[model samples]
Target: MSLPVHLAPSLTGVAPGETVEVTGDEAHHAVAVRRLRVGETVVLTDGAGTSVTGPVGSTGKRVFTVRVDDVRREPRPQPELVVVQALPKGDRGELAVEVLTEVGVALVVPWAAARSVAVWKGERAERSRAKWQATAREAAKQARRSWLPEVAALARTAEVVDLVAGADLALVLHEGADDALVHVDVPSAGRIVLVVGPEGGLSEAEVAALVGAGARSVRLGDEVLRTSTAGVVAAAAVLARTPRWG
Candidate 1:
C-alpha cells in the first residue's frame, strides 16, 4: 500500500536521517483526522518536484515530525499535458479537476466558453476556483504524485486562444470534427494542450478562433462525452501515445 502523503511548503536539501516539520492544516489533518502516530510511516511532498518518505517521529496538536528515510526529486514530466476545460455547471468542475489531476495533467485551465452554463463572476468565481485548486490538491496526494497539477484561473476564449497558439500540439474536441484524437502526433518533450467544450458545446466563432490559433478540431469517437469527463479521456489518449504513459 502507498503511504499517505501530506503536503509541505518545501523539502529543499532534505536528506536521509533528517527530521522535517509539517504544520498548519496539513499537520492538523495528519494528526487530528488521520491520527498518525510516532513510528507510523508516511510520505510528504512539496508538490513541486520533491517527495520524502519516513516514519513519524512525533505528533502535536497542529504539527508532526517525520524522520526522513528517503528523498526523491523528479524532473517535471514531458511532454506536458495541459487541458483547457470549459466550466461545467454545479459540482462537475471539482470532479473534472480531480480526475484530470489523477490522469497526470500538468495544468488545467478553466475556460468560460461562449456556451458554458455555469457563470463565474465576482466572489462566486473566487470560491469556485478555490474549490478546483483544493480538489486538485487532494487528488494529487491520492494519486501519490510528486508534482501537483496547476489549476489556472478561469480563462476567457481569447486567453485560451493564446495558450493554444503556443503549444507544440493543440487539439479542440468537437464531435463534428473529422480528425480523431488517437491519430494526432504527440511530441515527447513539448506541451500538448487539449480544449474541451461546454455541455452546450463550443460556439462556431470559438471554434474558428481556436482553430485559427493553430488548434486542430478533433474527436474522441462517435459517442459524445460530458465536459467534466472529456478532458481526462483526451488526456489519457495523449498520454497513451507518449512515453509518459509507456
Candidate 2:
C-alpha cells in the first residue's frame, strides 16, 4: 500500500535526516485519526511540488515530527488543465471538485452561470468556496499529488470569457455541439480550459459569448452526463490524449 500523505505549508530546503515538525489540524488528524505512531513511515508534501518520505520520530496530542529519509521535487506538470464548472445544486459541487482533483485538473473555477439553479451569495458564497477548496485538498492527498489543484474564487461569466480567450485551447461541453472532443488537437504544452454548464444547461447567449471569446464548443459523446461528471469525463478524455497522461 502507498504511504499515507500529509500536507505541510512549505518543504523548501528540506533535506534527508532533518526533523520536520507537523502541527495544527493536520497533525491532529494524523495522530488521533490515522493513528500515526513513532517509527511509522509516511509521506509529507508542501502541496506545491516538494515531497518528503520519512519515519515518524515522535508524536504529541496535536503535533508530530518526522525524520526525513528522502526528498523529491517534481516540476509542475505541463499542459495544465483548467475547468470552469457551473454551480451544481446540492452537494454535487463538492463531488465535481473531488473527482476533478483526482483526475489531475490543475485548477477549478466555480462559475455562476446564467442558467445555474444554485446561487452563491454573501456567507453562502464564502462557505461554498471553502468547501470546494477543502475538498480539493483532501482529494489531492488521496490522489498522491505533490502539486495540489487550486479552487479559484467564484467567477463571473465575463471573467470566464477572458480565461477562455487566454487559453491555448478552450472547449465548451455542449450537448448540441457537432464537434467531438477526441478530434480536437490538444496542445503538447500550455493551458487547456474546459467549461461545463449546469443542469439547466447553458443559455444560448452564454454559449455565444464563450465561443466568441475563442472557445470551441464540443461534445463528449452521444450519451448525456450529469453536470458533476461531465467535466471529469471530458478532462480524463483530453488528458489521456496528452503527454501528461502518458
Candidate 3:
C-alpha cells in the first residue's frame, strides 16, 4: 500500500470541493516518494467520516493538488466503541493501541490498573501517552480510517470507572466472570465501552469497583487472552453485533 492520504487543516471547515490541495507531508509523500502522476486518483479522508475521491493535479514540495471527482460521507457508527485497556507489559502496551485503532475503536483510555506491569508515572507517563497517540495516528492512516481514535491520559481504576460509567454499556472482560461476552444485551445509547485488564489481569477488588460502577463483567470464552489481544477481540465482537456495521 502507498502512504495514506491526509487532511489539511483547511479541509476541516468544509467538505471537499472540486479542487483540494494535500500539502505538507502528504504532498511530499505523493510527489517525492509515491510518485503519483497528475491523472492518478487518490483517496483523501478528513478523519471525521468524510472521504473524497480525487485525481492528482500537480505535485511539488509543499503543493499537491487533487481535483475532487466524488465525495462520500460514511454513516457514522451508531454505537461508538471505546476501549479502556490496561497498560500492557513492555512495548505490548503500544501494540494494543495500534491494533485497537485499526479495529475502529472510537476512543482509547490507558488504565493503570493495580496489576499493570508497565507503569506510567510522571515524565514516563507523558512520553508513553504521546507514543500511544502517535501509534493511533499511524494505525488510523494504515487502516484508512476517516476518524482518529483518541488516546486519553493514563487513568487509575477509579478514573476508568468514571469513564466507563459515561458509556451506555460498560463491559469488564474477565476470566473469573460467569457471564459470556454474548450475554450482555446491546443498548441503544449509541456508545459502548469495554474495560480490559493488564497482563496480570484485574484484581478482585478492581472488578468489584467496576461492577459497582455499572460495568457488566463479561468473559470472552473459556480461554484467557493476552492484554494486547483481548481489547481487539472484544471490540470486534461488539462491532459485529451492531446493525450499522452488519
Candidate 4:
C-alpha cells in the first residue's frame, strides 16, 4: 500500500538518515487525527517537486520527526495544463479547484467572467482565493502529487486573454462551437490552457474576445456540464492526448 503523503514547507537538501521535523497544523493532523506513531512510514513533499520518504522517529502533540530513508526530486511535468475557470456560485468554485488539482493541472486561474454570478471583492476576494489555494493543496497531497498546482490571483477578462494568447494551445469550452475537444491537436511540450465559462455560460462578446486572442472554440460533447465539472472533463480530454498521460 502507498504511504500517506504530508506536505512540508521545504524539503531541500533532505538526505537519507537525516531527521526532518514536521510542525504546526500539518504535524498535528498526522499525529492526533491520523494517529501517526513512531516508526510508521510516511512521505513528505514540498509540493515543488521535492519528496522524502521516511519513518516517524518521534511524535508530539503538534509535531513529529521523520528519519529520512530516501529522497526524490521530480522535474515539473511538461506540456503544462492550465485552466481558466470562471468563478462558480457558492462552494462550487472550491469543487472545481479541487478536481482540477487532482487531475494534474499545473495552474488554475480564477476568472471573473461577465456572466459570472459570483463576485470576489476586498476581504471576500482574499478569503475566496485562500480557500481555492487550500483546496488545491489538500487535493494534491491526496493525489500524491510531488508538484502542487498553483491557484493564481483572481483575473479579469483582459488578463485571461493574455494567457490564451501565450499558450501553445488554448481552447475555450463552448457548447455552440463547431469543433470537438477530441479533434484538437495536443502539443507534446509547452503549455496548454483551457477556458471554462461560468454557470450562466460565456457571453457572445466574451467568446469573441477569447477567440480573437487565439483560443480555439471547442465543445466537450452534446450534453452540457455544470461550471464545476466542465473544466475537469475538458482537462482530462486534453491531457489524455498528451505524452504526460501516455
Off by over 4 Å in 2: none
Which is superior by TM-score, 2 or 4?
A: 2
- Would you estimate the TM-scores of all the predictions? 0.99, 0.99, 0.90, 0.98
For residue 68, model 4's alpha carbon misses the true position, in angstroms, by 0.7
lDDT digits (tens) for residues 141-227 of candidate 1: 999999999989989999999999999999999999999988888898899999999999999999999999999999999999999
Tens-place lDDT digits, model 4, residues 96-115: 99999989999999999999
Residue range 1-246, candidate 2, lDDT tens digits: 999999987999998989999999999999999999999999999999999999999999999999999999999998999999999999999999999999999999999999899999999999999999999999999999999999999999999999999999999999999999999999989999999999999999999999999999999999999999999999999999899988
- The C-alpha lDDT values of all candidates are 0.94, 0.97, 0.83, 0.95
Give the residue spans of candidate 1 off by over 4 A.
Answer: none
How many clashes in candidate 4? 0
Kindly list the per-residue Cα lDDT of model 3 for residues 1-246, writing each as its tens digit. Answer: 563466644444445557887777667766888777787878788777777777788777867887877777776667888999898888888899999998889889998889988888899999999999988987887888877788998888889889777779999999989999987788644789899998888899999999998899999999999999999999888887777467
Candidate 2, 143: how far from true, in Å? 0.4
lDDT of model 2 at position 179: 99
Cα lDDT, model 4, residue 12: 86
Candidate 4 lDDT for residue 34: 98
